[model samples]
Target: MTETQIWALVFVALTFSVYIYIAWRSRVRETRGFFVAEQNVPAIANGAAVAADWMSAASFISMAGLIAFLGSDGSVYLMGWTGGYVLLALLLAPYLRKWGKFTVPEFVGDRFSETVRSVAAVVAIIVSFTYVVGQMAGGGIVFSRFLEIPQAGGVAIAAAVIFTYAVFGGMKGITWTQVAQYTVMIVAYLIPAWAVAHTITGIPVPQVSFGRILEELNALQAEFGLDQYTQAFTARPQLDVFLVTMALMIGTAGLPHVIIRFYTTKSVRGSRWSALWALVFIALLYTTAPAVGAFTKFNLLQGVQGQPVDALPQWVQNWQATGLVSVSESADTITSITNKATVFADGGADLLVNNDILVLASPEIAGLPAPIVGLVAAGGLAAAMSTAAGLLLVISSSVSHDLYFRYVDHHASEARRLGVSRIAMGLAVLVAIYFGINPPAFVAQVVAFAFGLAASTFFPLLVLGVFWKRTNAAGAVSGMLAGLAFTGSYMIHTLEVFGTSAHEYVFGISPEGIGTLGAVVNLVVTIVVSLATRPPSHEVQEMVEQIRYPAEREEVGAN
Candidate 1:
């Protein structure tokens, strides 16, 4: 085995060891310990945990890749994801903690009705399931490249590791696991960026130090005629880009996995603090990613735009072996010359470049040595695996705690409830693996779909259900169902037709841009339905009031 191979194995072992250690320490026998970390998590620590868990495989791998390849348009993810959580802090976090349920669907059931709760529960599963597969795919990619495992084998191993930590550690395990993951992923992402930026522009953190990068990049663009995506929006002078950002921002606040993090803190103050900390953690990686991406893109053009095909770099050869990169082959002399060419004349140089390699390739592009590149592979895996575990915990709890305990056995013993939760968690991991192996042809594209779906379906439901008491069960149900149906159908159309690339489908309404419109549909349906139906019972109104202000009442407690 190669030295880089050994380093990769050592890195994985070190990360897994920490998770095993935390799991042993944080293991809980009761349902409370398993699902909610006993609600004793400190604010800053929980924020760090939330940030670690929420910034998954896609963020680590694709965020920079998108920025580098797509140029400024990639900023949409940076703004949408980070800005969305601001809404989570301002609007959702405190109230949910006060309502104090073990799971999000539990709160939905309580606020609206059993029906609304069940519907929300199902929707949560869809969003989480679709997104988790992306994480699993990332894990497989990491193992396939770094550890030399077959892609299928690597994915299964990831499933097994996620199962071990998530099922046994529960939220408690996932929380601390994420703490470790955050460390591995952020360090992995930032160090190379620091080195590259310093070498190129004499800055460590690229986001704050954009002054130099901007100057260098503009010089390159001016000399080379580099067409950037962000320039398109700026040149056109329109609000289409603005609307897409709003959809991502609103949708992020509504993601179930992210919201559940707030519930771990001990107090409302803790909740707010956690959001701030999480932002700091997220920003550390976020700021550097775009600069890394842009630099990588700039370098790629300079190196390959007119290079001979047979002279492709060794790194490209390694990437092709992993199937992450694909190319069309030809032998005609001029066509051979055309085949050798990297960048195309009109635009879009290489369709062969995987959207997932930006982070992994940053070290090499900057001419960093072998060991640092190996470290990046490990970091990518940490991002993917840590997120898979957190997602599994939620899916498991949805089944074992919320569905089984709430509906199947209202009087089941605590041990019995915990047992069922474990079983459900086991089953969910298997299903996630299944999806990973036979992932729908559009797995990558589904990342946008998950964000769009979450923003559309759940954000509105959670907001009105908590803050607006007059939103009767009928309205709540209608709003959620309408969002789910409209978005689901649109998503099916998106997947069936578009695969992954963005297009001007029906007046520039791309899948990523549809959530706001979906939320609007949900809101309209909810209002119309609420007016059409009887007001919620006085008891339900009282429940909404209780959730709106959780910090005040220590009276009833978690019965």
Candidate 2:
């Protein structure tokens, strides 16, 4: 194969080997070990794992691409995602760690009732399933480009690998695998960014060096009769930005896969420390994303905006072969194009560029080396695969641990529980592959929907469950169902799948921003219903009070 393909295969194989080895080495026999890594993972390792899990394909493969095109509006994603971690650490992580539950549904079930627990389990399954779709699609994109395979082939290969580790390794194996993935992801992301930043701005610090590039990008946009790249509210409404940011922030706190990371830590202190370390690891990538976005935007405009269709760069041509990027004289038929409004204005250059391919193609667009491109391919896959494994575990635990063991067979043996969990994960992998092949939206957007759903369904429940002692089982159930139904239906009605027009949106809010409203709905319904109904039992109230504080007995025992 080609040099880039060879290098990509080499890095991918090496990383996959490491992941499989870790999974095999760390495989667990007991349910506790499978679910929470025996609650013995150190703070630093869990932190890196959390960072890797949270970043996902959306952060590594698609966030910068969104920023490249959406410009200043994309800052909402950066702010929302990072800010959500702060919320998680301060408001949720330590409390959950204090409770020391294996899954989020377990917390809900214990805090409320068995019925609420079952509902929460179903909600967790739905949210995790939706989230995995983006991961599969992201992995497919990376493999299709670098490995020179069809997207379907790429997705199947990734599914098999994810199954090998996630189904076999459980949470213990997934944890260590994610730590390795974090190293791969961060290095792959930063190295190319460092190289390009230094090459273009003569500065290696991409985060601080992108100001000059942003200015030039704005100037290029003005020349092309397009809106300035740094201009905000031009592509999206102001309210939508605020609402979407809120959804993403709370959504990050609410995501089950992310929350479960804190539960893996040894103590509440460890959980808090893990959050801090995760932010440190995450910031390394987040700070540099703007630079990568700016550099890619500048390069594409300067290098290919008006270039001949037949004479495009090899990277563009390569992507075009995957059917994601299209260049044609016809404006209506192209898949994606920057500034389509301006490009169509004067017998214009019809250069269609899918945002998903922008980051993967960034290195080649900047004329970086084949090895760097391959490294990036591996990084993107790492990001996708890491999150995919975490999501599968969530689904497995929700079904086998939360549903089957708790409800179907209350006395099921450890071996039976593990078997069911693996089977659930295997099924989840197959379903995720199907959705990956037929995705509802671009990677980031589909993930946005998941975040929105989580924010609406779980954020209010978890927050109220922890802080408000009077929150009864009835209220929690009503709030969760209301929030989920509202948010899910709104997304279905407004998203492209249902063909709803933007004009029909509720007060001009986009599907991505509706979760903020849904969260509010949940909070209101929960509070009102709780006030009207019987309060929680004295024991449940005491449990809430205890989880609110540190687990001193456990801490003393451990010490």
Candidate 3:
């Protein structure tokens, strides 16, 4: 095997072995343990696990790429996701933790009616499945590029590994494994970024050097007659950027897998603390992403623009083998004895570099050592696998715990429930694998769709359910259905799915941003319908008050 491949194999084996060991050590048998890690995880460890779970392949592998391609517009993801986490911690996490349910659907069931619970459960499943497909696609990318395997083969292998640890170890195992993953991915991400920053600008700190790099990149882009590197709204409309940012922010607050992390903590305060810790850890990478994006883009332009096809860098040739990148001779291929002005613009057109490969190829592009390249490959896999495990667990719990056990057999034994969860997880893996092999969009884009769905369908219900006591079953159900229908239909219409051509976006909102409008629609419908219908039962109202203020439960009981 090649040096990069060998190093990658070694790193991958070591990391996978560590994950399996953690899963084995932390395996659970009971339902509580499976669903919420027995609610005994310490705040710091749970924080790390939460970070690992939240920063999936999209964050680790694709976010920088998005930034690289979209320029300043990509700041929306960084801002929306970070801001959304704040919203979740302040607005939802503490209250959800106080509610102390095994799953989101369980909270809905207790707060509303059985019918609403079922609907929430189905919605949770759909959102989780949609999210998992992105993770699988990302993992597939890492495997395909590093392991020299086909994307489909890579996806199947990732599915089997996820099934092994996630199904057998459940939430308990997934939490500990995620902690390790966070460590791996962060270290892997920072090392290359630091090296590249130092190499380019003599500053090892990416956050500091990226500013200098951006100036250089803008000059280079201008010379090539391309849009400036710091330009915004060039790739997407201004309205879409705002709506997409809002959708991602609210959606982060609403994702089932992320919300469920709070339930794994010992107390509501633990959940809050964990959220704070997760933000700190996540910020480490988010802060560095722009630096990495600028550095990689500058490197690509400088290294490849005027290079001969036969004399291209080994890294470019290597990636080209994967068919994600391509270079072709243009009419001016033989007349390339020119300055930078004529290269990117007039001579041979630029190489078709896929954004998804930017981060993975950055180390190689910068001529970093093989070990760093392999470490990045391993880190990408960790990011993808860690999030995929969390998502799969969410799907399993929603289906088995919320739908089957709650609806099918109230008296089902723990063992039987666990069996059903494993089977559901296996089935979910199959579905994820299929979609992974045939993803509808890029990793970050597909994930954005998931966030949109979550924002529209669950954010309004959860917020209104906790903060507004008068939100009855009718209002909750109506709001969820309306929001989901609107968002789902918009996405289906705007996205080229199932061989259908995309229609014009409504009001200039792209599929990625439509969820914000859908959420608005949901909130309006929910308020109007709640006012029209009778308020919830006195008991349910009391329950809502208790969720909002735990001390009130004892006061109400005494009264």
Candidate 4:
């Protein structure tokens, strides 16, 4: 590590300190406080917290890296994440908050039926665990890269820290801590992206510079005999893929962890304001990633040409020491491993160049010193931790609200419920740590899976449930199950069961984006099933109306 790297570490450490301090100071005592920060959070603060928690490692580390490698094709994530927020502001947040529940499972149960609520609880746990594992893995990647530790060791350290804050403090603690984490992650993501952009095209605003880079990228592709790659996608009508994107856009509004954030707001208006705040905060990083990606790609093509395959710049060397970057050793090995030849150290560098490292490798490609690289590591960690904490809250509440209060002990005191929540939180952290050590998948890839699942399973039901008066419990359950089953089975057969070398793709659409089909099947099944079943009861229809309007309705009307 260089002199600059030491200072970057200091800044990152200071950021962590601030998160701990703020979270500790904000610890809440009541069950409501633990669940929703006692509903006392200001709109701006809650928004920041939501944004920080929502933008995970994939947003910080993986998306840029994906963009760096995929060029214009990478805008999927930019669109997916941002589109989710728009859906939130336009459709989900206001109604969800007006429903006035601390946990999404609780709302689902109340809205549809106890059975539907029970099913939603299962889905929430799966979604949160799957998503949070990615966050924890991302944290491990940051730790490995910056702290010069083994991947498992790094994951352990991060898990320990996440556990300390999430278990002890609850939502009140996690909420304020997320606000601090938001500042760290956004600054870390933007500053380096800005520096890289200025160096590449002399532009201070990364969004503009990124556009310029894309122009040059188009030219570069023409030079590299890759004009077809650039032009091929245009002519390629990915109908199924288009469907997946639709599902994702619909799904974003319904994610349980994301939905729960609205409950922290003191009022319906505050929820609206928080959504806007999240959008603003998210925009800072999203706007910059395209630039960072193009610049990194350009620099990589320049830096790594024809050298000894293992030769990397100082920062690259440092990252290798840290382990954020992975490689397969031979072209044949990559061919054998297919596109995912991402495992490092055991003869993979010559075999494959992981696209995941593109952002982490940016400084090295540009010959920037280690300190900037270190800062990137810190940024990645902030993103992971912030999102992980938010997910943990959701997971904890799944047990506390859905199972404990609903079935285990309907009369359990609030304090007893809180204690159960802490236990659940601790268990969630343990599960996250387990996945982090033995990573099940790529950071961005895993997140995409979660999104697709959300799109197919959660989004359709929530949207229909909220807006379509005819959508009933039978439809919701059938839709969610069909979406989940179709997506999972199709992806496994198409992506994993069939090898990439054999060209195992379903109509050339990736598993990462294919759930769009599942979503459609879900909607169709839901419609069919609802038609087959009776309309929801009067009380359920009335519940829908309560969430739709802003004016205060009678308490009798609310239930």
Candidate 3 lDDT tens digits, 1-559:
8899999989998999999888889878998898999999999999899989999999998888778877888888889888888988888888888889799988999988999999999999889888898999999899989988889999998788778888888999899999999999999999999999999999899999889878888887766566777988876789989998999999999999999999999988888899999899889999999889989988877886656667777887899787667664563222122212234355354566677888999999999999999999999999999999999999999989988887688998879888888899889889999999998877777888889899998999999999899898899899989999999898889888768788997778888888898899899889989999999999988887777763334555574
**Which pairs clash in the backbone of model 2?**
336-352, 336-353
lDDT of 2: 0.88
**Rank by lDDT, descending?**
2, 3, 1, 4
Enumerate clash totals for all models, in the order shown.
Answer: 1, 2, 0, 17
Better of 1 and 2 by lDDT: 2
Higher-TM-score candidate among 2 and 4? 2
Give TM per candidate. 0.91, 0.95, 0.95, 0.90
Write candidate 4's Cα lDDT for 1-559 as tens digits: 6465585678777877777777678766678988888888899999899888888988887887766555555556677678878888888888888887788878777778888888888889888887988888888776665566678988887777777788778988888888888887877777777788888889878888766766666665454434422432442245643654565666567688888999989988899999999889888888888778778766765554344545644544554554444444453221111124433345433423455566666766676666777677777788898899888898899888787788878898877888888999998888888888887777776777777777788777777888987888888888889999998776676654334322366676767666677778888999999988999999899989888887676698676
Clashes of 4: 17
Report the lDDT tens digits of candidate 1 across residue range 1-559: 8776787788887877887788777778988888888999998789879987888888898778766655667767889889987889888998888877688888888888888777777777878898888888888888888888987898998788778878787888889888888888888888888887777777666776655555566555554455543465542223546667778898889888889888889987788889999999998888877888877766655555445677666666777787666444531111111111234333333425676875787677667877788888878988888877777777887776667776779998988888888888899899988878766643346677788888888898888887778888889888888887887676666555435543335565566777888899998998889988898899988877776664555667755
Q: lDDT, candidate 4, residue 69? A: 54
lDDT of 4: 0.75
Q: By TM-score, how accurate is candidate 4?
A: 0.90
Local error of candidate 3 at residue 269 (angstroms) = 0.6
Q: For candidate 2, write residues 18-125 as lDDT tens digits.
A: 988998899888888889999999999999999999998999988898888889998888998999999999999999999997999999999999999999999899
Task: Arrange candidates, best TM-score first.
Answer: 2, 3, 1, 4
